[model samples]
Target chain A: MKKIINDPFNFVDESMEGILAAHSNLLKAAEGNVRAIVRADAPAAHKVAVATGGGSGHLPVFLGYVGRGMADGCAVGNVFSSPTSSQMKQVTKAVDSGRGVLYIYGRYQGDMMNFDMAAEDCAEDGIEVQTVLVTDDVASAPREEWQKRRGVAGLFFAYKIAGAKAETGSDLSSVRTAAEKAVSNMRSMGVALGSCTLPTVGRPTFSVSDDEMEIGMGIHGEAGVQRCKLENADQIAATLVDYVAEDLPFCKGDEVAVLVNSLGGTPLEELYILYREINRLLTERGIQIYRPYVGRYACSMEMPGASLTLMKLDDELKELLDAPAETPFFVQN
Target chain B: MKKIINDPFNFVDESMEGILAAHSNLLKAAEGNVRAIVRADAPAAHKVAVATGGGSGHLPVFLGYVGRGMADGCAVGNVFSSPTSSQMKQVTKAVDSGRGVLYIYGRYQGDMMNFDMAAEDCAEDGIEVQTVLVTDDVASAPREEWQKRRGVAGLFFAYKIAGAKAETGSDLSSVRTAAEKAVSNMRSMGVALGSCTLPTVGRPTFSVSDDEMEIGMGIHGEAGVQRCKLENADQIAATLVDYVAEDLPFCKGDEVAVLVNSLGGTPLEELYILYREINRLLTERGIQIYRPYVGRYACSMEMPGASLTLMKLDDELKELLDAPAETPFFVQN
Candidate 1:
C-alpha cells in the first residue's frame, strides 16, 4: 500500500496535530497533551460528558467522535494500539463535570486494562466513571459467547445514541444504559478484499490472494470465519445481511437503521451498490429500514473491503438516533 | 482494482437506484427516469432552480449536490461519460418552475455539447436558462488560457456558492454570476498514486509504478503534467499548494476556503496528513484559510490520489458559503 505520510514515528501524533489544527473551534488538546483531546466546550455544566478512546489509524473513530452530542473527550493511542492509562485519565478529568463521565469504546484487552486503570484512578479523585465496552462484531464469537465479540462499526451507534442521551442531561448511569442498549442491539460483520500496511511496520498486515476475499474479517486483519472466491456485490451483501440478520433474529416487523461502511479504500459508489442489494433483501424479508447511512463511518487504514452494521431500533433508540450530533467525522441533524 | 460490483453494464443505473432507495425522502427520480434525478421537493415556487450533471463516478458531485440550498436536479451518465442531451432535458424540465433555470456543471466537450442541446430545447419551452462552466484545473492550461482548463473539484464550490444564491430566490442571471465568480476565483491540482478501473473495461485506467506518483492528473486519469518517485506528505502538499496558489496569485491576507479532496481510494488519514502541511504552508504565506474541507469531495472512481482546491473568498462568497445546505452527501448548517 502506498501511504501518503511523513516519518513513520510521527504518523499518529502528526495526524492528531492535523485534526486539532483543522478543527480548533470544535476540539482542543487536554492540557497540551494532543493524545488526550476534548471538545472545545468540555465539562459542560450539569451534563454527563462521554469519553472514548482507542488506537489510531481509524479516522472518525477514537478521536473524531469528540464534539457536540458525541464523545466529549478521547484518549488517542498509536495505530492499532491502546492509549496509556495516564492519557485516559487526562481525558476523563478534562471532560468530566460533577455529573460524571462514561467510557464507551471497542472491546479489546489492551483498552480494557488501560480504561479500567483510568476509571479506578478517577474514582479516587471523587469522579464517577462508567464504561460500556462495545462488542458487536458477531464473527468474533458465537451467540452464547457474544460478550467475547469485538466491536466494529457498531461503535458508531453506541456513540451517537449514548452521546445524545448524555446531552439530554441524563445521569451517567442513564447514559451508560443507553450505550449498553445500543451495543446489545447492534451487529456487524466485514469482508476484506486486501490488506493494509502499518506506517512504521511497512508491510501488508496479512496476505490474501487477489482472486479471493476473507469474509467476516476483523478490522485488524484477524482470521475470518470464511475465505472464498470473490463474489459480486449482490451476493456479498446477501451473505453479510443473512449472517447479521440471523444473529440478531430480527423479526419481520422490526424497523432498523442500516450502515454500509467502507473499511477504507472502497469508494462511496461501491457502498451504494452494496446498499441497494441490502435494502432489497431487507424489504423482501419484510424488515423496514428506518434510516440508512452509507459511507465510511469507521475504517482500517486503506484496507480494501467493507462492513455491514444493523442496529435494531425501538422508540427510544429511534429518538436518540434522530437527535442532532456534530462530531468531526459524523453529523446528523 | 477489485471493485465490489455486479454486471458492470448495470453499474450506473444500479448505483442510481441505490441512492434513490437510500434517500427517498431527500430525492426522487424525475418522471420515473432514474437517469434524471431531482430533489424531492424540486421546482420550488418562485425560486430559480439550479441543475447540474456529469458522469457517474464522482459521488456528491453531479447528483449528491441535488438538495436544499443546492442544485435542484441532476442528470447522471455512465462512468466518466456525459449524460445524454435528453437526460439533461428531463432534468431541466422537471426542475423548472415559472422561474428560470441555471446549468452549473464541469467543462467537458461532451458535457458542454449535451448541456447546450438541452438548453436550446428548454429555451423553446419558454424557460430562461444560463450556465457557468467550471474550469479550475490549473494544470490543464496556463494562466493566460485558463478558460481552456478542465474542471475538477472546483465544481463543489460552484454548486455551494451558486446553489445558495439561487435558494435566496435570486434570478438565473444572479445565480449564474455567483457560480461564475466561484469558477474564476478557485484553482485546483491533483496527484495520483494509482489508477482506477472502469467496471466494464476491467482494466486500469492508467498505470503508475508502485514507487511513483503522477502530479496534476485529471479526474479521469488524463495524462498528468509530471510524474516522479513518490514523496512524503509534506513535499506532495507543498507541490500541489504552490501550483494552485501561484496560478491564482493569491495574495497575502487573502481569505480562502481550502479543500483537500481524496480523488477516490486514498484514505482519510492520508488526506489529513496532507492537509496539515497545506494549512501550514498557507499560514506561512500569510494567506488566511477561512474554512477547510478535507476528505473525498469530488472523486475519480476508485483511483488512489487526491486534489487540493483553493477558492479566494469575498464577502458575498463568504455569506453564501455560510448559508445552510443539505444534500444526500453534503450538509452545512
Candidate 2:
C-alpha cells in the first residue's frame, strides 16, 4: 500500500494545519487540546450547540459536515481511534452558547467513554451537555437488541436533523429529540470486500480472498458477520439489501430513504448496480421511496464493500432534508 | 482484478438489469438500454426536465445525480464510453414533458456527437433540448486554449447549476445559461496514483508504476500528461493545485469552490490529507473558498488519484448552488 505523509503519526497534524490554513475563511479549531474543527462564524448565542466527535478516517462525515446545515463543531482523533474526553469537552465548551449543547455520535466503547466523560466535564464548566450514541448497524446485534450495534453511516441522517434543528435556533432538548428521531428511524448494514491499510500500519487491516466478502464489518479492522466467496452484483445486492430491508422491516407502503454508501474502495458503478437491485426488491415489496443516496458517505480507507442505510423519514426530517444545506461534503436541495 | 459477470459484453447489460430491478420504485432505464435512469413518474410537465448523458463508470455523476434537485434523467453508456445517439434520444424522449429540457453533460467527442444527435431527434419529436458540455480539465490543454480539453468532474458543478435552475422552473435557455456559466468558470485537473481495471477488459486501462502517478489523466483511463514518481500530499497538491490555480488565474480575494475528487480507489482519509495541503497553498495566495468538496464525485472503478476543481463563484452562481435539490449522490444548500 502507498500513502502520502511526512510520517504516519504526523499525517493528522499536517492535515489539520493544511485544512485550517486553506479554509481559514470558513474553518478553525477550538482553543486547547481537542483539535475540533468548527465554523469561524459560529456565533455566541443562548442557543444549544450540537457537536459530534469520532475518529479521523471518516472525512466529511465527522468533520466536513461542520458548516451551515450540519454540525456546529467536531472533535477528531487519530485514524479509526476515538478522541480523548478532554478533546470532546473542549469543543463542546468552544461551541456552547449557554442554552446547553448536545453530543450526538456513534456508539463505540472508546467514543462512549470519552464522550460521557466529556459531557460530565461540560457540566462542570456550567454547560449542560447531553449525549446520544447512535447504534444503527443492525448487523451488529439481534433485532430486539438493535441499539447494541455500532453506529455507522446512518449517523449522517441524524446529523441532518440535528443540524437543521440547531440552525432553526431550537433548544438542546428539541435538537436532541430531532437527532434521536432520525437515528432511531435509521438502520444500516455493511459488507467488506477488501480491508483497509492503516497509514502507519502499512498493511491490510483485514484480508479477504479476491473472490470473497464479509458483511457487517465496522470502520475499524473488526471482523464482519459473514464470509463468503464474492457473488455477482445481483447476489451481492440481495445479501446486502435483504439485511437492510429486514432490519428496517418496511412494509409495502412504508416510506423510507435509502443510502447506498461505499466503504472507499467499492466502485460507484458497483454502488449503482447494488442500488438498482435494492430498489427493485423494495419496489417488488411495495416500499415507497423517500430519498435515496448513492455515494461514499463514510469510508474506511480503501476498504471495499458497502453499507445500506434506510432512514424512516418523518415530516420534520422530510422538511429539513429538503431544506437547503451547504457543507464541505454534502450539498442538497 | 476480480469481477462478477459471465461475459464481458454482458457486464453492462446485467448491471443495468440489476439496477433497474433494485431501484424499480425510484429509477428505471429505457427498455433494452442501460443509459437514462429516469423517475418512475416520468413525463413531468409540472417541472422542467433535466437530462444529462456521458460515459459510464463515473458513477453518481450522470445517473445517480439524476433525482430530486438534480437531473430528471441521465443517459449512461459503457465504462468510459459515451452513450449512443439513440440512447440519448430515447432518454430525452422519455423525460421530456413538453416543459423543455436542458442537456447538460461533459465534453467528450462521443458524448458531443450523441447529445447533438439526440437534441436533433428531440427537436423532430417536438421536444426542446438545449445542450452544454462542461470542459474543465486544465491539463488537457494550456490555459489560453482551455476549451479544447475534454470535460471531467467539473460537469458536477454545471449539473448543480442547471439542475437548480430547472428545479426553480427556469426555462431551458436560462438553465442552459447557468450550466454554461458553470462550465466556463470551472476548471479541473486529475492525476491517477494507479490505474483501474475495466470490468470487461479485465486489466488496467493503462499502467503506472507503483511509485508514480499519472497526472492529468482522463477519467476514462486515457493517458495523463506526466508519469512521475509519487510524492507527499503537499507536493501532489502543489502540482495539481498550482496548475488549476494558474489556469483559472485565481487571484487574491477571489472566492472559489474547491473540490478534491477521488478517481475511485483513493480513500476519504487520503483526500482530506490532499485537501489539507491544497487548501494551504490556496490560502497562501489569498483565495477565498465558498465551500470545499472532498469526496468521490466522479470515479473510474477504483483508480487511485484525486482531481482538483476550482470554480470561481459569483453571487448568481452561489445562489443557484444553494437552491434545494436532492439526488442519489449529493445534496447542496
Best by DockQ: 1
Q: What value does the lDDT take at residue A39 in candidate 2? A: 73
- In candidate 2 the C-alpha lDDT for residue B280 amounts to 72
Instruction: Kindly list the per-residue Cα lDDT of model 2 for residues A1-333, writing each as its tens digit.
Output: 566565688777776675675566666788834377777776446567878888877765687677777777889899888988888877888888888888888998999999989888789879898887788897778888887878999878878878888878888888888888888788888888788888888788767888787878887867778888778767777777678777767677778888888887877667766777788777888887777777778888777778888888768888877666566677664
DockQ of each: 0.74, 0.39
Q: Per-residue error at B120 for model 2, in Å?
A: 4.3
In candidate 1, stretches whose alpha carbon ends up further than 4 angstroms from where it belongs are none
Error of 1 at A142 (Å): 0.6
Tens-digit per-residue lDDT, B1-333, candidate 2: 554344567666666665665456667776656666776667666667888887777776777677666788888788778888888888888888788888887778888888898898889889987778778988787788877788888878887778777777777788888888888888999888888787877877777776887788888877778888888888888998888888878889998888888887887667777888787788899987777777778888788888999999999888887776656566553
Question: What does chain B score (TM) in every candidate?
Answer: 0.99, 0.95
lDDT of each: 0.91, 0.78
Tens-digit lDDT string for candidate 1 (B1-333): 488999999999889989999999999998899999999987777899999999999886879889999899999999999999999999999999978898998889999999999999989999788988999998898899898899999998989998899888888888889899999999999999999889999999778998999999999888889999999999999999899999987889999999999987888888888999999999999999999888888998778889999999999999999898899988877
lDDT of 1 by residue, A48-69 (tens): 9899999998887878888888
> Which numbered prediction scores highest in lDDT against the true structure?
1
Q: How does model 2 score by TM-score?
A: 0.84
